[model samples]
Target chain A: MSLDKADVVKIAHLARIAIDEEMIPEYTNNLSGILELVEQMNAVDTDAVAPMAHPLDMVQRLREDQVSEENQRDKFQEISPKVENGLFLVPQVIE
Target chain B: MEWETVIGLEIHAQLATKSKIFSGASTAYGAEPNTQACAVDLGLPGVLPVLNKEAVAMAVKFGVAIDAEIGKRSVFARKNYFYPDLPKGYQISQFELPIVGLGHLDIELEDGSTKTVGVTRAHLEEDAGKSLHGEFQGMTGIDLNRAGTPLLEIVSEPDMRSAKEAVAYMRKIHSIVTYLGICDGNMQEGSFRCDANVSIRPKGQEEYGTRAELKNINSFRFVEKAINIEVERQIDVLESGGKVVQETRLYDADKDETRSMRSKEEANDYRYFPDPDLLPVEIEDGFIEAARAALPELPDQKKQRYIADFGLPSYDAGVLTADRETALFFEQVVEKSGADAKLCANWVQGELSAALNKDGLEIAQSPVNAEMMSGMMQRMADNTISGKIAKQVFQAMWAGEGDADAVIEAKGLKQITDSGAIETIIDDILANNAAQVEQYRGGNEKVFGFFVGQVMKASQGKANPQQVNELLKSKLQA
Candidate 1:
């Protein structure tokens, strides 16, 4: 399925990123090319082929049901770009 | 307009592995940032991921847990995505051949109705790093600490009809993951997360409606709210003769609404091809057999056994087996106390759960342990403590840091079941309450309770209530 410019605009808006209008045509063109490639797989006689989920067959491996460690917020916060009173600082995006 | 809510989910859970999936980096959380990310994770050029044996073992373990078809051989593919967190140019995931196949999970709703949700697949993948947006005026902060963490992506079919069922399905998944020790099931730390795909169609329509995918539902509450809002939004659009747009949306928990981030493009085809760097994983019969043997009793089987073997009601068994730790604790109590199984289940479900809830703690951090609880229950059975006193003893035992008998002795909380001593106290009470005693003698039978109360008070509220009642009734009749 070759999606047009309208499809690209809509998908970007749903995913919550502000996409520039100039980027729309390029994205649309690129996505259609991908869809075309996936179409090649469709030509295979896969009607009887079961959909594959994972790569291996295995069973249960259990832990000793113990909590071994705690998160180091102090250490993690040290790497944050902006920290105020042990809390991460972010730009005000909402009114 | 007639409509039906269609929902599916993609659950990402961190596997319980001592080492990271692709690299041998310690899977241990809370370490200093940049410490755990190895050369492979840091994307030092030419650094390749050496698959962790534990990670593969866990993947197979989960495959067996879900009763899914496991392929003898599985392959990994490269999913190309450019982001700060995904240090590798592409994330190596099981695109074509995954280890676990289709499975079904049965969920029980609060209304006592059961629904079956189909698990489309469970696959292995590496985690991306955390990107902190809005950290600066003109830039975003990137934390590469979480990069390359092993994740098990559990995809569910569009079998759920309502938000209630979606939540139910998530809870069942959560229980299984936690029970099997595959995932910590912590939403806050994002050890576990769910992405919801929701759409609405005519109630009986065979063709599917356009769907929207929402990410960042880190908690169950968020999942339910995000799906509900999205479902309503889709329904409203359809009813107004407007076409529902197919796109990806992010749930803004603060606003409790989903606004279009961007229109969704049909870009699922990432040109997935087999990853050549790593070898295909081949599991043998012995491997599957070992995994099966290691499988501790699953929740469903344990629930059934709890009901049949312990003579517990269905609800009680469900509550006890909801988490593995609680069930294990109950078992230990039963083993030590050798008390009635039903009563042991009661203490675990009733008193133990109450305390755990009050403190917002899991069973591992609970002040009460199984053996101690069993000792306390024994005290109750032996009449060493009354029901009312048992609660007091329980609290004392919880805070006192000792066994039930020790706490009882230290607090001097033993029940007064001495018949001769109780008779003396009862006689003294009768002498003092002469007017009430005379009335009781003249056939005001209820006055007997007042005398019994006096005897209990004389015994400092520890008098055997049943014995006091019997003695008071007989003495009053005389």
Candidate 2:
């Protein structure tokens, strides 16, 4: 589960974070430490216990399927970096 | 060695809910960009997701229809990835525990043989916004109107052996969802779409080969073509002493080939963990029972009923029940016209379908309705018009000429059942064609057809064929 410098660099690239070459070693150490702690947790023998996903034993709240919102495109698009023809524009992205 | 193609599909059916899955924003299509995106859909600070009961009910309905295990408690997980279309860095979806468990769907292949495809699971997820790449000036445009729309991603086992079987499996799912009234099943609008995982191995290989996923194929035809092309590519690669690389490929339908989009190493990790904002969904027996009770007759059941009750062929039943609107139209025609089932089936499949195809219209968009069609059928039944003249009358009705009665009256297309008028026409025809009559009486029975043609010509094609045959036989015999 230990992450090396190359693994750290790959992770950073996937996350779209521009990290310096010198910072990769430091990230590798920190990420490997976190993974070691997770491995330690995973070492426990609690096979009979049911897996838990939520802290509180509560079910999700349900809402009626009705449209209550009105059009606010002009106001929302005002905060975007770029917009044209009622579309939020970005640097071109190919599939 | 013969190669075998194995395929499994992941279908995303957009649920027909009034609003987004976790927000109050409208989920209606073709809205102005970002207008329908509410605070929750936009991932504003400190926003939490609440499940839509209608969407949950719909998922339950599908589970019950397919006879799947409806999970009493299902956890929602956050699949973390980065993309421009995803306003939130993570999409809320189910991973380990889905709402629907292992199920099966029975699909009828082209050879009229049925096969059961195993359903791995169906999970709920929120859709990302659409990224329009080419429309703008070298810039990508994002439409958030589709953001947070609810989708049921149905995963299937690797049970398909060919492209045709895969298409059949997809079509069965399409019919089922539309029949349940849960999804609109509009592939063009992208309410229904699929990603296909394709692989190929030797004829008797126990283990599957490295698979490639064909992403976001929107139509059934494209699904078949994409899978066929991918299978051919994989076989070719293996035969050339190369291995098929695990990757995501895009089907360029215009080019009729699959090109690599991203390889396994470049693929996103999609680190998945349970969502903290939303709690696990728990269902009660009462809810499941109510959903089951509310379920309509599914496509397979309706197809069986059409075959059993109406005596329709298996193929006709399949075609008629492929869509809900067409089935309802057929039922209405039967109820109104009280016509024979086979005749009704033939007319709907033959004349009506042909006309609809010619005009590029769906049954729902037909200018002539069930009532109008039933009236025409009645005219044909009562010896009022021949089937040939009925088609002409239908064309007239389609041109907005009026109903059956009006069209028949305006065109004087009614059958000539009047015995006295037919007798006069026959006598005039006989007097004019003395040579043909003599030939007929001189043991030349083949000349009877000419006499009948002459009589029909004199009657302007209004003579009832059966009556004309009987009357001409007696006259020629005497």
Candidate 3:
């Protein structure tokens, strides 16, 4: 139930969170304490109950398939950091 | 030592809906980049997603067509990943519970045998945007126009052992989705795309070998080629005393090779969890029943009906009913022309198919539609035009020269079925070719074909072939 320093480092890498090398031990301890609380909750067996997708017991609302939005490229792009030719430009990402 | 190749396909079929799956943004393609992207699709703050009912209905219809179990309560999960195309840093997809589950499709193999490919599951997911890689000042340009589009990701089990079978299976799925009117099935437009998982093992082995997923195969031909190359690569790896590493590989269609996608491989660990913003979607029995009732005749049913009712050969039936548009066009020709079903099948499978393939046009985009095609067929059936002359009329009709009657009249290509006219042409031919006529009387029955050809040629290929044969026989023997 407890996470080690290596585990914290890997988790931070996966989550795309940047942490200092010296901060790894402190973060690991904090994360392990949170896991301990989760372990206590998991100990309460509820095998008969089904897994829930949401906390609220409500169904999702459905929308009709209609095009009501107009072209707002200028309005939306006003807030972007970098845009060219109506495209949002980001650092080069190749896959 | 023999090796067996195991191939499976994961197809992403964009559902034919007017708007985005969870937003009201227009899902039209080829728009100005970012023009159609709204707040919800851009993942702006304080925005919530509502499911599109049409997409749900379409998915249900697909499940019904495949005779699959439709999940009564499906949950949407967040697939966390980092990509420029994906704006929200995660994609809303189905994790454990998908929309359609445990379906199977029967694909016709090269040997005319049918094999049932198991469809593991089909889940609904939102598509990511496009990242234009080059010529963006050394930066990638993101277009969110494609984001939030609904895609039904259909996964097939590793049941195929060859590339041909895999293509057949992919084609069958394409036909079914298009038949259901759920997906457009346009590969060029990226509406319908496929990724393949390929592995190889020793013959008679129960355990599957390590699989490498092939991505970016956009065409059916490429699908077959990529899988074959990947399988060969795996065999080479194993034969050389090396183990194949499981990774994602890009299919370089230009070089006809697959190279490991190093970056995408490290990002494979997708931590999936249910999206708290969306609750479970519970389907009612009434909705399922409605989808079933509204289901049109699928390809298999239509093919069988063509065999039983129309007396068409199974091969002809299969070719005619390959896709929904082609099947509808064939039926329209039959209904409008009132010609024999066998003849209708021939024209549809022969000239119509050839012209469409030549021009790279779909049946729906044919210049000579069902009405004109059937008109031409009618003329042929009623002996108003000889089969030879009908081809000329068909060509003219295809060139926008008008329908059957108009083209026949315009080009003076009508059949000269009048016995008097045919007899005159035959007399002229017999008189001009006395040497051949003498040879005909000298027991050279093969010379008879020469006389018939001469008569038809004299009549400008307008003489009815059967009439020419009978009249030539009486004259030459006399």
The best candidate by DockQ is 3
Residue B231 displacement in candidate 3 (angstroms): 1.4
Candidate 2: stretches off by over 4 Å: B263-265, B435-447
CA lDDT, every model vs. true structure: 0.79, 0.90, 0.91
Cα lDDT, model 2, residue B317: 92
The per-model DockQ list reads: 0.09, 0.82, 0.86
Model 1 interface Cα RMSD in Å: 8.6
> What are the runs in model 1 whose C-alpha is more than 4 Å off?
A1-95, B1-3, B134-137, B263-269, B431-458
Candidate 2 lDDT by residue in tens digits, B25-80: 99999877888988788887888888999999999998988889999999999998
TM-score of each: 0.80, 0.96, 0.97
Per-residue CA lDDT of model 3 for B112-204, tens digit only, reads 889999999999999999989896767999999999999999999999999999999988899999998899999999999999999999999
If both were scored by DockQ, which would come out higher, candidate 1 or candidate 3? 3
Model 3 residue B393 lDDT? Answer: 89
Give the TM-score between model 1's chain B and the true chain B: 0.90
Candidate scoring better on TM-score of 1 and 3: 3
lDDT at B190 for candidate 2? 95
